[model samples]
Target: MSDTLSPKAAKLHNRTLITTYLYEHKEATKQVLERELGISLPTITQNLRNLEAEHIIELGELQDSTGGRKAQSYRFAAKHRVAIGVALRSNSVCLCAVDLYGDTVQERTHAMSYTNTPMYYQRVGTLINEFAATVAKGGSTVLGVAFSVQGIVSADGTSITFGTLMHNTGLTLETISQSVHYPCIMIHDSDASAMAELWFDPTIRDAVCVYLERRPGGAVIVNGKLYQGPNQCNGAIEHMVLVPNGRQCYCGQRGCMDTYCSLETLPEEGESVPGFFSVLEQGEPHHRERMHTWMEFIAQTIVNARSVIAGDVVIGGEAAQYLDDSDIAALKSRVQQLTPFSTDTFSLHKSRCADTNSIVGAALRYIEAYVDSICTDAE
Candidate 1:
């Protein structure tokens, strides 16, 4: 829950907290920071001073006081530090560089099969490093790396235990990080994507996110925190057998959401989801129906999730490229037809639209861990 170090970590912890909030609100006075951070005046002043000295944060114009003296406000220097996040699925890898506020600064991706092989990791490492080199070229300093993969990630961001959807190659975090060749870390694909929503999304203070990429996996966010259970695979929902009596999933289950909803369910050679949609666009009613079934399955899953950790469902993946207004509406309609409610609260999200999400999420998580390490030492 906290970062490492004694006084330095305490200072970085406070800076991370203050800067995190400021990244959202844009600006806040010391009094507002005190109320939100719940720290003493000296601690606030001290940390803010340290952050300013480090060029990680900046002070803006003062806010008018209510019948009192004006107070100076603080804001995160979004450009001062840079972070990288990478989302690696079974078929492809996406790497991005993001700013302090989760803004994509630079990004690129490489195409590869998710199956575990030395070549795949080598390719992934090359892509990430290539993007980092791009970041350096753009004159932005790189801070750290975050890796989001499809499997069970350790809480410490050190290793992956179960990767049902990845190359099935059984890769070790140590090996991958060594290949990564920077200050690197790892996270579950869902949790890392959810971190994208957490540090940057303003409306989602509380919600549940079910992210589906070409690879089937997801993470849940409760009270603005990713709920990672022991072994760090709490929300890896693709393994959950929804039908228990249907199609065989890669995870050895019948009729799971992943089997029905993923592109893998649709066999093709060297095809993108956009190409699949293009087929539908060319009037392939069968593919169209496949999409409809996919959305319906997603809806039913959300409706079922309501009994547990329900709030709002977000659909995001490489498949999101073809999610037109009509597709989204149809998905909503299907959910409406199946669920108790008339209106659909589940939202569709797209990360491929943002070039820097992976790097950004990685950077943010790294910074968060850096701060979390500091606080626990004191406790």
Candidate 2:
């Protein structure tokens, strides 16, 4: 490699860099961009003009003068573009539209069965198009859509390789994309939830997000990026055999972690996880004992996973939000005692996104892809 950029390539690189920088910082003065990007004043000005003309960025305010003329500040026009995230569940599809700043602009939940027929997919497509039109009313461009499915997703994010909750296997992206007429990608729901945790909490660069939803699963993050193993099952912790011959699992396995750690294990007294926790919080001895046992199982799984992966464990999904700080601390203590390694501290975190983490994360995937495309074009 020559280790140098051609004039044309350099210009593209600088433009992408400036745009990305503004996106991260929200707003910055031209002087700050020039200093940080190490580009000349004229080059920065030209790039800013180009970005502004494209409606990607706009002048915000004047920077405070330092014994000289004040410089103009710029910010990304985040509302100018939007991305859609669809969370496909067994009984409903939850849609969310997120702006460039990762804020949810609109959300809607549509009730539907996870059918393996074209008619069902077409209906989903129509709903997505109608939602997009609603979002576009404000003159925002619909960049793309990402679907979150609770299953094993293809490495390319184009299909559902396998799913225990969904009736369809090998479901192509076109099943939904054909109706919406937009770029689309499919993501494992667990992976999407983990991405949401990483997005909200930057401190968690490397961690295992244990998703304790209706269908239990997990996602592995290493070096600030998702690490999909050779078979794209790197974080399929739910399949880990907890007992040799215990409760049966949907994956045709006996005593799988999912059988013990999933929401299905909870009592039917409450309709939702939060409602169940409310009963526990009221000093209900039966539910308390049940929760204790559940926490113990989760602790064991975390210890076993940490022995191999060696990172913080974040409990995510609908149930995580209901777990108080004391509950998490107790779980951490249990994991510490179970682990063989000598560790002074254990990093356990609760998910910030309540029930919509996966939805936001799905949208973030497309937004990140958009940014990556800009950088790739520069390259």
Q: Pick the candidate with the highest TM-score.
A: 2
Q: TM per model?
A: 0.71, 0.90
Report the CA-based lDDT of candidate 2 relative to the real structure: 0.84
**Tens-digit lDDT track for model 2 on 1-379?**
1129787777788888888899889899988998898888998999999999998899899988888999889998888888999987778989999887678999999989778788888889999999999999987899988898877888776777886567667888877577877888888888888787777777777788898877788989998888887667889999999888999888898999999999878876545676777788899988888998998899989987887888888888767777889998899988988988774465897877758888889899877777677545445
lDDT measured at residue 322 in model 1 versus the true structure, 0 to 100 = 60
Task: Provide backbone clash counts, one per model.
Answer: 19, 0
Candidate with maximal lDDT: 2
Badly placed stretches (over 4 Å) of model 1 are: 1-53, 57-76, 89-93, 111-134, 137-139, 167-170, 179-181, 266-272, 282-284, 340-359, 368-379
User: Which ten-residue region of model 2 has the weakest summed lDDT?
Assistant: 370-379
In candidate 1, position 89 carries an lDDT of 58
- The models' CA-based lDDT, in order, is 0.68, 0.84
Candidate 2 segments whose C-alpha is farther than 4 A from its true place: 1-5, 34-40, 62-71, 268-272, 375-379
